[model samples]
Target chain A: MSEIATPVQPQRAQRYGLRNYLQMYAVAARQAVIEQLQYPAANMMFMVHILIEPVIYLVVWSSVANSQGGAIGGYTAAEFAGYYIIWTLVRQFNLAIGPQGFHWRIKEGRLAAELLRPVHPLLPDLGYYLGYKIPQTIYWLPMGILLWLLFKPEINPVAWQIAAFPVVLMLAFFVRFFFMWLLGLVCFWTERVDALFELYFAAELLFSGRLVPLEVMPVWAQNVANFLPFQWTFYFPIEVLLGRLDLPEFWPGVLAQLAWIAGGYTLVRLIWKLAVKRFTAVGS
Target chain B: MLRPLKLFGLFARISILNEVQYRANFFMQVLQSSLSLGTGLIVLNVVYSYTDNLGGWSQAELLAVYGVFVLMSGLIGSLVLPNMWAFMEDVREGRLDFTLTKPEDSQVLISVRVVAIWRLVDVLLGIVVLGVAIGRMGLEASWWLAFAFAATLIMGMILLYCVLLLASILSFWFVRVWELMEMMQSIFQAGRWPVGIYPDWLRLGLTYLIPVAFAVTVPAEALTGRLTPELLAGTFVFTLVALFVTRRLWMFGLRNYSGASA
Candidate 1:
């Protein structure tokens, strides 16, 4: 018998390491930028909508604070400004997989093409979203600065508060991304996600610290909000940056975020499996 | 004009028939509208928990404003918004050629071509809310007040039509104006509150530029007995001028359409 030379095959896990994932992320991010830059005017229009809400709230909350004869929810006028300004950046970071594309794919029978691809249907969409943030971030910086200058919000954070902000924000983005993807997946079971989306949006506005700080929300509502995953998405990060949650509260907050992320990922994986089984490669 | 009117009537019937085939959509619309109206009331509740009045309107008075917002929102959702959305679709898919070839006026045909009849759910809800609000406010519904409210609401419809049509017409010259339409919606959503609460610049913009005040606030004012003769007259005049200008712009858009097709 003759000895045969054999090639050593790398393990599947080793094939895609940190570098490969980083490359994938860069490609996805770049593709997103290219797609969004095609419509500068549309991007500008979106910026107007994005900037409008926080501005409206900034004014609304400021007036509410004034009428209360000092501060409502432990936030003075300047504190409200600080909350919304940082919040503007936080929101800028939180634009996840778009509902529009999800709806369109189902409505137009284009999800079939996405499913046929070797990659997960969500990867390109995530890339597309990251690209979307580039323009949004560019627009946000100037707008945030202007809001900061205009409102002069007294947001003096300690070193760790400033440093830990981005990490918490990234977690918020993933949680939002995964949770919203679950909503998008529900399009598989029904043609009308419009009502569902509206319901989700209403709940989010109430709980996510977008409408008012969660602190000022009625005690019952705050308790309900804390039980849910949404508070981790916006309000938690915003408060963390404000140094509202001290070290003891902060560690638990981080834990809650991790728990939600783990829970969301599991839910998405399970739903995608069951949904793909039910899916007819078209609108349900 | 009579021919176009008849054509519009036919188009509206067709749209209703098409939508009625999907019976589930009606229920979904009701659910969505209720949820939307519920959110508005909840926000109001939250705000009023802290203060009695917002921007000079008491709780009941603000509810009156909300009722007007809902009513106009319903009418727009059922009529103007769907058609404008369809018009953008037409522009994109080159379906405008069919409407242009029709004997009736193109603008009339395009404008009333589709109606989501189920959205009247919001309109009826609006009336109910308004009645409750008005009843709570103890405002007299003089026959004159009724007439004035109707008149201002009609003007509001006209102004809303003008704004939506103008926004849709931009599709003739550009692509993907969905964000613009959405921008309009968010701005209009602010009308759920008294535009009075907004700053001077935003108030001015909502009143004139976006015209949400005309669509919602002014009629609300009529119900609340806050409508001044000057404001009513101005709204009427503004609607008239806007109608003429939008018509002119529509005509110009038609010319552009023809030029594009050529």
Candidate 2:
């Protein structure tokens, strides 16, 4: 019948305009907000799960700094507290759909349904994760306050730096999101990618200043980090909020983030075309 | 006790047979464990670069702690966690009814149901690291210390098993308990560092609340010459009490479970 044929043809030929894409993102993000908000207790526990990592690092580094007579690698114990407390917030913001989720999507045939949609699947994911930040931040607030009270962290961000925090925070999210998508696209090429994923995460853990400040890392590691995009996600934003980076240092970090975003976006677009061409669904 | 041991051996054999068919997983496990061990060493190296000792632990002694952490993680990963996850999934799907109907202790059956055999690579790797750390430290070797280490390691495994089993038994009341399980695991990562470095409240929590101190730290202490007689005796008592409580809770949870399918 023309009804079925017409539906297939139009879907094949149709392209979404900018306004429609924006609306799609809004809806996807709203759905994520509602879905996540429905599971508050689980999300709170998940937040605690996330928070423990930074707390461990904070405690370790604080002790080390104290043991060294109140300072090491230019960080006092209180500053270390401030850095890792901000780390908790940055962690919430930069959380993205991991490669494991992508592997599951493919294995479970969820990607088959996604392929039928006119818009890129990545767009919806971006919107969803963007929306996820809302619920995530809500969950983070009580924990953040508790950490602040418990640690008595000393952060002194100036007015302009404070104003710029949200912008950099969102940019950091984009950088990590795009890169995570790029990582996830590897699922298209191989099913046995766990080792690769592990390697990638280990590199990120070290290079991203997630484990320790880049300054505190050895010179070799700090040099390696300079050439990587990982630091822009965790280190830059935390420093911006911790009042560590000055204006001279700040603008270049922002530019680097924007540059990485553009690079990641381009890579995803190019590889996605190849990935889609290779994808063949077995069944519904 | 012998029956439970036999059951565990049979289940472990079957699990090994099932897993060995996918031999590539062993390589994957190796890669993952090595990467984590590498990162852990890097963190220790960086920390020690600034100081001679951390919480009175020399670099080699901390490496011993790291070794115990990796080893216990392997044992838990291979023996405890997979079983707990499978048991929780079974509970959720009403498969617990089948488990309950089996002609054996349900707790032992559930506890030993699954073994991720390849994860024992971590156990092997942990022993190697401990050997290197001890070699580096050059401590006086004694049978008493070795006995203490072996005893604490067994008790640590039991304490960890009891805590994890207690958490798993909660699935009868709640549909989703994996998040809580995950939170507990994250809290356990605190053991990668000695609990002595943590603040008072957290140290107390890790020691008594979750028993990660007993699980990883005390065993490491046995090797590092930090285990005192009083603390060792206290840990043993705690382990026994935990095992008793877990048995009672398992019975209670079994009663609470109504088969979703039946």
DockQ of each: 0.65, 0.79
Q: Write the per-residue lDDT of candidate 2 for residues B100-136, one digit (tens) a residue.
A: 8899988999998899999999999999999999999
Interface RMSD measured for model 2: 0.8
What are the lDDT scores of the predictions, listed in order?
Answer: 0.83, 0.91
Name the candidate that leads on TM-score: 2
Identify the CAPRI category of the predicted complex in candidate 2.
medium
Cα error, residue A213 of model 1, in Å, equals 0.3
Candidate 2 ranges with C-alpha deviation above 4 Å: A1-12
Query: Model 2: per-residue lDDT, tens digit, A2-84?
Result: 12111111135576689998999999999999999998888988998999999999999999999889999999999999999
The alpha-carbon lDDT assigned to residue A201 of candidate 2 equals 92
Question: Residue A277's C-alpha lDDT in candidate 2?
Answer: 74
> What's the distance in Å from true for residue B16, model 2?
1.3
The alpha-carbon lDDT assigned to residue A102 of candidate 1 equals 82
